[model samples]
Target: GDPRLQHISQSIRVVPHFPKNGIMFQDITTLLLDHKAFKDTVDIFVDRYRDMHISVVAGIEARGFVFGSSVALGIGAKFVPLRKPRKLPGEVIYEKYSLEYGTDCLEMHVGAVQTGERAIVIDDLVATGGTLSAGIRLLERAGAEVVECACVIGVPEVKGRCKLLGKPLYVLVEPRQVDQCF
Candidate 1:
């Protein structure tokens, strides 16, 4: 990882027991607040992909949108948003993946990605790899060759990378875990 990424790693705020128990949530909202850190986060991604001949950058909903659009612009690739169900109004294709509780789906507009286009998926964090896997499947099913998945933070202990089906994953920071001290 780049030395500058240290700042990116430190900027993340970890919240314990978020929406449940014994779960440490790696939050990037704090990173979004620091202008330099935020810009650096996007810059690091842009620099990595700018020379890769990438044609499409698919962001996995909500948080992925933040970095994806900027990276697409910087890399001269088209930005494609893989959204939640029914969030897109046009013709779409979707892929569903399992979660700890239930299943969730990701939708992409039909014809958003051309056949044989090289693409990457961006998100803020990757935990279970379920959502990222669905995003890759959605793009691959559309005939796009998914080149990689990128994220700001990663939780290695959860082994999210195992679910990506051999697709490469890149992360700027490995999360720092702290006990729930309140």
Candidate 2:
């Protein structure tokens, strides 16, 4: 309904061969620096779920924390951090999944979401769908009805969308082409 999506797309910085060769790393730090763009991104997400009866917002480790917490605050829901092993305190349930490089695990506190609470999982990007998929499994196992998985960006070329196992995925934007940075 507005130019917020364009702002988000423009604020991201694409780095060539980051963390490895042949990888175009999509960076969002630039977006964070642009207060308006950042706020709009969160507002867009909040608007989507504010009235959906979402009791919880499950944010994946790292990037998800940025937008997820804001959305939770805006929507009046609890924010749960789905973290790496040993990051979450007390009794936690974990799910291990394979990524392009290796296998990793995500852990959430056992009581983060009570039985039947509606939740939405957030991540910065969906690359290969491993991280979001694992988060969904972790939440579902604990009896949370994951409303949907949301990401700021999606690399459809990686086929992460297909690996979601029928869960709805919402992305703000996909690169128009591999060569287009914004």
Candidate 3:
């Protein structure tokens, strides 16, 4: 077994037909339950960005919060959340994007990131990449320089990385992308 991925991969529960038919969900809840696996996952990111001088850690809503906040704390950067519409209290900026199923939007506080600040967008995985792309767009509109995007897993067959349009992608585990499977 590959020591680097053995524990982490094992911790991820592959649930078939989740949320819909013919979907294989890479559930990280099981990974979260394994303290060592979870810490190792974050450590992989922390060690990579600790010295990169990233000014802001922009995490996508929900799952992104878990790893993004931890990485922010480790790197001494502020954690900015890209949330669903109306989830933020103050004035916010939003971006509309297309998901595999339908279109949705992401919102961030007006001043979450300062002009020219370096930011890294975080999400658990990159399947279709629309959501991450939207977050990057929103940050750029706010005048932030998005340094890159980070995820634990990458679904490359979906060509999600291509949607970034030239931004660097940092990921730990890259399973073969199944085009038709969710």
Candidate 4:
């Protein structure tokens, strides 16, 4: 059997009516406050791909940076950022996708991932998988082989798993609902 990953699964707080009503946001600040939890979260990815030849760790913007940077550092790999439009400097490659509310675009430096390098995309959570999918496409277009995609949390109700069908996905925690607590 695959190693049980429940220990790293944490119950995070949910702030109801956040940014808008009827939307309960999964707050990861609680998990960030715990050092052991943070380390374990990073360890989950490091342990899984320790032997793989990962040249870059591509982290989705904002929350992804937190976990991705640390994992990249731990594994002695370079960290690349997948950011929202206009956030990154220099020549950037862009991909547009629809969000739950509206459409948005993600940008990355043209040369962030070198040709033929292996990368692991990291993010804090996977919801509909739109952003993650865009990230994968962007990396592939730049000639990077996406070895895997990993996240700290995954919300299956939104068809997140289906969006990542062809990729190896590793999540530290798989929660039924975004609002569900540990």
Candidate 5:
């Protein structure tokens, strides 16, 4: 693992039972608060991708935007947002996927990614990998070659990477559960 990733991992706040019970949510809001960690997190990604000759950076809605946009800017590529249903205000295409409990969907605007363009998907975390899978499908449907999927953190126990259909995944950290004090 990258040594800088250790610093990145240490900054994350793990909240037990977030939005539900028996779930250890790796919260990145704390990482965002530390200036050096935040910059390092983005820098690590930018450095890896800067020489890849990527054409587009497609970010999963919400958290992905935080890193993907900056990465795109760094690499001089266009930023594409894969959003939740009805969030994009244009002629959009969508892909529906299964979640652990129910179903969710991701949308991308038409023409956002040109056919045969080299693209990468970005998200903050990968839990079940369903979300990243959907993003990959959407890009493929748009005729883009998804170079890879990148996230800040990964939950190893769940094996989220298994659901990615063989697309390479890059994660900065795999956080271990720390006992909750509060």
Candidate 6:
């Protein structure tokens, strides 16, 4: 199915110097504030995977939670959180990856995804694809098959590093300048 990038593009706000210097954060908070926009973002994912058998929806830390949970609810699938280091309460499988600012780690609950479960990883954006790669590794370690990845936005320049080639990628929008705010 063809994804609609226009609506998602219109809803995002480019914020400069967020979290630190030289980083242009793609703020989806503005999109979340609008009901229609928020629903559209979720709908895009739901439509894309309507025919696929998705048992769980895994969202990356922080921002990914906002959209991932909504998509999970919309599609009637379980929601799993791929969180920051030491965030998960119980036993977790961890993976470390580099971020735009510095190095960081992501973790998932020990039993978040059962063996052979079909899962989809969701995030707000994919820049360097570091976070997404970490999430994929963690899920695979837990014995889940990652069917696809969904993001609100994709920065192709960063993805060109060859981190996201074999995965089926779906994005609501792809901005020309992912680091413009920096």
lDDT of 1 by residue, 32-138 (tens): 89899999989989988899899999998899999999999999999999999999999999999999989999999999999999999999888788898999999
- The Cα RMSD in angstroms, rounded to one decimal, for candidate 5 relative to the true structure is 2.2
Candidate 5 lDDT, tens digit per residue, 1-182? 46877777888888888878988878788888889889999999899898988999999989999989989998899999999999989999899999887899999999998899999999998877889999999999999999889998887753334336778888777754983422
Could you tell me which 10 consecutive residues in candidate 3 have the lowest summed lDDT?
173-182
Candidate models: Cα lDDT each: 0.87, 0.86, 0.84, 0.80, 0.86, 0.80
The regions of model 1 sitting more than 4 angstroms off are: 157-163, 179-182
The digit string of per-residue lDDT tens for model 3 on 25-143 reads 78878789989989998888888898988989999988999999999999999999999998999999889999886899999999888998999999988877888899999999999
Instruction: Locate the minimum summed-lDDT window of 10 residues in model 2.
Output: 156-165
User: How does candidate 5 score on lDDT?
Assistant: 0.86
Using TM-score as the yardstick, the better of models 3 and 4 is 3
Which lDDT tens digits does candidate 6 get at residues 58-85? 9998999998998888888899999998
Q: Which 10 successive residues of model 6 have the least lDDT summed?
A: 156-165
Off by over 4 Å in 5: 157-163, 179-182
Per-model TM-score on C-alpha atoms? 0.92, 0.91, 0.90, 0.87, 0.92, 0.87
Q: For residues 1-182, write the lDDT of model 4, one tens digit per residue.
A: 23434444544556777878876666677778877777777886788766798989999989999999999988888999999999887999999988987999989999778899999999988878888898898999999999889888876553233437378777666652455454
Clashes of each: 0, 0, 0, 1, 0, 0
Candidate 3 global TM-score: 0.90
Worst 10 residues of 5 by lDDT: 157-166
The lDDT of model 4 is 0.80
Model 5 steric clash pairs: none
Give me the runs in candidate 3 sitting further than 4 Å from their true place: 157-163, 175-182
Ranking by lDDT: 1, 5, 2, 3, 6, 4
Candidates in order: C-alpha RMSD to true structure: 2.5, 2.5, 3.7, 2.9, 2.2, 3.4
